[model samples]
Target: MGILKILIIVTNINTYAIGNLETGLWLSELTHLYHEAKEKGYEITIASPNGGNVPIDPESLKRFTLDEVSKQYWNDMSFRALLENSKSLNEVESESFDLVYLAGGHGTMYDFPDNETMQSIIRNQYEAGSMIGAICHGVGGLLNVKLSNGDYLIKDKKITGFNWFEESLAKRKKEVPFNLEAGLIERGSDYRKAFIPMTSNVVVDRNLITGQNPFSSKEMAKVIMRELGKLK
Candidate 1:
């Protein structure tokens, strides 16, 4: 089989209004997946709503939170360039990739939902049978996607994202606009998560896959790879 082509979508929103918090793509969420995909010989492309210099969530770059892989990615100039020069969503074709990944951060809460171009790309990719994956708030991107059958993309699908408890635990309950868990439930998705918070939790339903938090990043990539028959 030819190398799998993957498109990674990141958030452009950099600051949260509450506490004026700094937010962007979680570095580990993107790096863990990118490292795994690269090792598996997959072609990876980074893109965003407006593209250009995708932000790394400030909190995620903290020394304590930085895992070895993420730290390596932070120092890798070549990899950094990919994030810096991500293609604009409008400029990429869905058919070119075999998989789509939504990297998470609080910032995604602001830009992932209700973007016509992002929705179109997702809709097209879904119809084309490409695998779709998202972690944390990145799953917000899937909320508004409606199929030609006039049903929400996640309707009746088993999915999970940043749960309500985690939001409150993170002390952003009032900061974020809406509850992601509630939104998924309202859209008819069978949302599931880890019994314990901040652990690796991933749910795969047909062509769609979702993770609960940044901790689920590597596991999410493994699931994607397994689905692609590239992992044992």
Candidate 2:
């Protein structure tokens, strides 16, 4: 099989909508997924809606959240540089990638959903038979994506994202713009969650793949690799 290409979209907003609640890309979400896809020899492109200088949620860089993958990349100057200079989403042709992955963070809620280019990429790439993967708040990007038939991409499709409870646990319930879980259901998605909170919960609906939270990164990445391999 030929090497597949994946577009990993991160966030440019370095802070939350409210006060000083800093939020951006969750480090583990990007690191874990990137490692999994890279090991499979997939061509990866790190990009952003506005491009240049992707931010990391400060909380995610705390001692509690530091994992081997995130920790390694956090300290790697080259990796840091990648985040500093991400490609503009508009510059890339959606057809060039086999998968478009939205990496989760509170910042995504601010930009991913409303960006026409993002919706275009998600809608177009998905319609063209490419896989669409998103984790945590990154699933915010899926909220407004419409299909060619004039239906929501997630309408009646099984999906999950950063839920209200997890947001409460993260002490960010007030800062997040809206309830992601509620929004998904309102959009007619068959939303599901892990019985136990903060566990790896991933769901697949056709070419759409989503993870419930930051903890769901590793499991979801494996699922993405397996599914993409099947496509090849």
Candidate 3:
């Protein structure tokens, strides 16, 4: 088979008073997807709401949190370049990828939901028979994407994301832009989640794959790879 073309969509956040400290994609999540896809000879195209240099949560890069693979991937010259030169949402065309994955972080809540460019990319990919996957707050991006038939793309599908209980436990309840689990249910999706403590959890429904948190990104990408290979 030929190379797999994968598109990773991230958020671009800018806090008015924080200087350049705004957060974008979580490093662990991107590390998971990037390495897994690269090992399988997949070409990656990263896009964001505003594109250009995307920011990352500095805390996520600390030595205690990330594994060696993640640490190495983050510092690689070529990989770093991809993050620096990401395509803007408006620059992505649906026909370019075989799969589209949404990487999550706190910043996603603000931009991913209402990005018309992203919604169009999802619609076009699904219509063209490509796989769609999101993890944690990344699923927030799918909240408003609709199909040509006038139905929410996630409607009636079994999906999972950062749960309400987890949010409460994080003590960041109010800081969250919106309630992810509740929003999924409100849209008629079968929102299911694992118990508290936010353990490793992943939900795959047909072509849609949703992982509960950054901890599940590796497994999530593996699942996506398996599903895409099956199609081939």
Candidate 2 lDDT, tens digit per residue, 129-200? 999999999999999999889999999999999888988898888888889989999999999999998999
Q: For model 3, where is the 10-residue window of minimal lDDT?
A: 14-23
Q: How would you encode candidate 3's per-residue C-alpha lDDT over 1-232 as one tens digit per residue?
A: 5888899988777431234445567788888878888888888888898889877866578777677778998879888888888889887863568889999887888888998989999988887888899998889999999999999999999999998888887665767768998999999999988775567788988888899987787788788889989876
- Which candidate number maximizes lDDT? 2
Query: 186 in model 2: Cα distance from truth in Å?
Result: 0.5
Q: After the best TM-score superposition of candidate 1, give how far the Cα of residue 55 lies from its true spot, in angstroms.
A: 0.8
Root-mean-square deviation of candidate 2? 1.0
Q: In angstroms, give how far residue 102 of model 3 lies from its true place.
A: 0.4
User: Which candidate leads in TM-score?
Assistant: 2
Candidate 3: stretches off by over 4 Å: 14-22
Candidate 3 local lDDT, residue 109: 86
> Across residues 1-232, which tens digit of lDDT does each residue of candidate 1 receive?
5778899999988888677778899999899889988998888889999989898888898998899999998999998888889999988854567889999999999999988898888888888888889999999999999987889999999999999999988888988978999999999999998999989999999899999998998898788888977322
All candidates: TM-score: 0.96, 0.97, 0.93
- Give candidate 2 regions above 4 Å deviation: none
In the predicted model 3, the residue pairs found to clash are: none
Query: After aligning candidate 1 to the native by TM-score, how far in Å is the CA of 15 from where it should be?
Result: 0.4
